[model samples]
Target: MQSVVPSPEGLAWAQRLVRLDTVSEHSNLELIETIADHLRTLGVPLRLTRDESGRKANLFATLGAPRPGGVILSGHTDTVPWDGQVWSEDPLSGSVHDGRLWGRGSADMKGFIGLVVARTRAWLEADLPLPLHYAFSYDEEVGCFGVRHLIADLKDAGIAPAACIVGEPTQMLPALAHKGVHRWRCCVKGRAAHSSLAPRAVNAIEAAARLVTVVADMGERWRREGPFQHGFDVPHSTAAVGVIAGGIADNIVPADCRFNYEFRELPGSDAQAMQAEVRAAAAALEPAMQAVDPATGFAFEPICSIPAFSADADEPAVRLARRLAGGGETTLVAFGTEAGLFQRAGISTVVCGPGSIAQAHQADEYVTLEQLARCEAFLDGLRRPAAAC
Candidate 1:
């Protein structure tokens, strides 16, 4: 589907947003306050949840009477960083060019947040019975961190929304299923020796490489296995080492090496069991290494884990998205989102928003004006008195 430039109102709001840097590494308070100030004018009740470090926050605001079964308009406030990428202008340009709004977070989803906020003003005067809740979160690029805190606080307050819509970049399709993202860090400790005496020394990098091989083998095995869901492009689970660092000059046998790997598992597979298998592989290598030097072994540390998400195709959230967008088909996205966390909290949820995932995390990232128009229309539909919240 070709994308035309978005409407001026939505484009203006999105441009203002992208100018602010809310990269996961940086604080999202600036962007949160920007929205909060405008929301305050609407006279809605607001609940703000901050992380322990006080660097990020989640803003949950309600526009009508706070009653049971209100609908949630959810989008993350954080964005991935653009450090060394080449761009036609500033990373935060937010310029309208080539029939798209160009900026770092324009597609991954600051644009959707802007559109929802802009449409909210009109709804304030609507006589709809159900409340509309706006949920903006932080650190979503880094393992869905901030929303976890927000969910905990919600649990404490005993507040649960009737349903939720995660504005991930899925081109406004209702995404019903996605894989779990589980990551772990493995560190190898070995003895150091000169290159000439390498035969007597334990090689941490070599040992780490062996485990990398195991991870690749596991990924291949999954590709050939059963329990696959046909809708997903890659129907089976997947595993691979994403990052690794170790080794010194060739003259030295590395004494320490560490690598991080993750597996995106299908609903039927046990992620913990997959991790345990990798740990066992490391354990098998431990005995041989420790024999050379008692201190030479490996250690495993968990980094982060986000569970796979799935929902009934006929659920209210799915049906609402389909109805609002004039489509009932549900898609399975390749990337992860906070929908799983919302589902864990017992609020039915689905991922749907404007823009394509292909534009996310790349230089000159953009969302078409046409996509924003569709999203604004979708958000506007929620204001209908008869639309199921």
Candidate 2:
């Protein structure tokens, strides 16, 4: 089969997709419906599946005959928030300048999604020997929720891909591994009292401060004593508190305090064990706080768990990705992505797409026209049948 090059129409489609503001928190139902309709017209078999909330959705489309070993092109439809950044152009306008497409999700994701959709037309036109599956997910910027359902559906149907290429921006290089992210919220409960008589009441804020100190101490210990074999810039797990809230007034002892923390762990590290350490520290603090007043307590709730993915350098999928990416050496990234989840589902996965991670989650995120063109060529190569070994 002959691989088809990206058409002008495909570029136009990508531009239109960039115009839709599907920020992770915003509803992506319209975008999902539009893509589903477009795939149906392109002779791709598409099924629209929704999570329990229906605020977001997943679209699974396939080309060529269904088979055991196929290729899955995956991308997230949601983007990070662009709430407080100064932009040279309208963030959602998909403006083009200097041969680059600029928009909210131009780099973080929608660019890759557009490329995959554009290539779908070529796959549909050719008589490919292997099937090509496209999985578009929502809320990836928040957590890996949308694809979890899609993966479960595929597993339920006993359909597993031979390989999955997650179109996360890698500047056209192949990424074989990335760190995992674990997010949690901790709450400290205490009794409130007048500042003048604070000794009689337990202060939630004070308890939370101790908890934060424990987290910082643990982070430092991990940096000093933890394994550091990974190639990540940090080279070890990192923990930090991102948000905190407590207190009513300077005069009153706070009754409740809450904060969210995250851990970016290296591949193969025990993320759960790290979380356990934090929990234990919080628990130990609780007894002290409760001794001041029997009402003090602590609780921890998980927000998200993103697993890490690392493929062996000699793996067939990595080799295929290198070839498709024009023979660049495989590398690792510190950010989290859905590639790990796909790999855990028994699909050899690699991360290779257009643009650079530097531009992701920025105000005027953009993807160079050159990178887009390279991605188009990569997809075209995949459409062609393999030569005899």
Candidate 3:
């Protein structure tokens, strides 16, 4: 297919945003303040909801008349880190080459955000029949963390917009459903002793290994079991231990070990129940460790929980997105997004945006010019009568 060139202003906006480094580990204040300044200059009323540390924030801005049935165009300001990845150009350069905008977040999201910000003037001049909002959040790559605070702020302000559109690199397609993500950190404590005196101490690493096996076994059971959703890429709920660390020397029985694990579950599945099952397994192994040392046991910490999201075919948010994108079939994605959180807050939500998820988080991530043009057209459709509630 021939690639359509995107609007120069939109391209410039995308490149400008992509140039900023808003990796999840780092603060997103620069990006947030930049967009805040632009919106403020345009006379848009906006609010900033900061995290507990006051280093990161979510930006919520409004345009047009203040009404109940307004629509929100949402995107995350942060991108995953590109450390240790080999790339042809600097990840933050935001270069335009070969009919695509290339950068760390060009596809994963900044492209959609940039285009939305570029449309602010157009939306303002149109005297929109219904209000339009911009919801740019932080730390989405790590989990849907920042958006939670944004939603809470909205609730406090008593603003109940009818619908939300989360732009998360859907190749310009609307996504109606996605899996949930629940993660945890587990720490095991035991007594350290010489290798020859190992029986006198509980082996923390060995205990953690047992827990890892239990998680793996559960994942395998889900893979072979009957509860399944056919459309998703990974058709069933899955679990795995991603990181683990323990021990100091070969001669010592490790006194402590830590590991991280997660579960990506289907829409109707009980993710908490799965977590409880793992906790039970850990509890079952605790008595043996406690017998060896009073301080030896297991500790678990909740990391992040992104709920599963699904929208009915006839939902207003889904209809609006499909109509603006020239009408395509809705999709189901394996990855998680803030749409679920929005839905939980009583806002009808759907995921749609420029680019493809396949290109996200890669060394040479890029969003095609064609996708940007399509996204711009979709945003322009908001000015039409059919889009009004």
Predicted structure with the largest lDDT when compared to the true one = 3
Candidate 3 accuracy as lDDT: 0.92
RMSD from true fold, candidate 1: 1.8
110 Cα displacement, candidate 1 (Å)? 0.6
lDDT value, residue 97 of candidate 1: 74
Flag the better candidate by lDDT, 2 or 3: 3
- Count clashing pairs, candidate 2: 0
Cα displacement (angstroms), candidate 1, residue 71, comes to: 1.3
Residue-wise C-alpha lDDT for candidate 1, range 1-389, written one tens digit per residue: 63355556777889889899999999999999988998888776789999989888999888887677878888998899888888878879888877788899999899999988877678888866688888899988989988888888777987778899999989988999899999999999999999789889999999999999999999998888756898888899999899999888989999999999999998667999999899899899888898899998888898888989999988888888889887766789988899999998999999999999999999989998889888888887888876756
Cα-based lDDT at residue 186, candidate 3: 95
- Taking all chains together, the TM-score of candidate 2 against the true structure is 0.95
Over the stretch 142-174, how does candidate 3's per-residue lDDT look in tens digits?
888899999999999998888999999888889
- Give candidate 3's error at residue 256 in angstroms: 0.5
Off by over 4 Å in 3: 1-3
Assess each prediction's global lDDT (C-alpha) against the native.
0.88, 0.84, 0.92
Candidate 1 global CA lDDT score: 0.88
What's the C-alpha lDDT at position 378 in model 3? 89
Off by over 4 Å in 1: 1-7
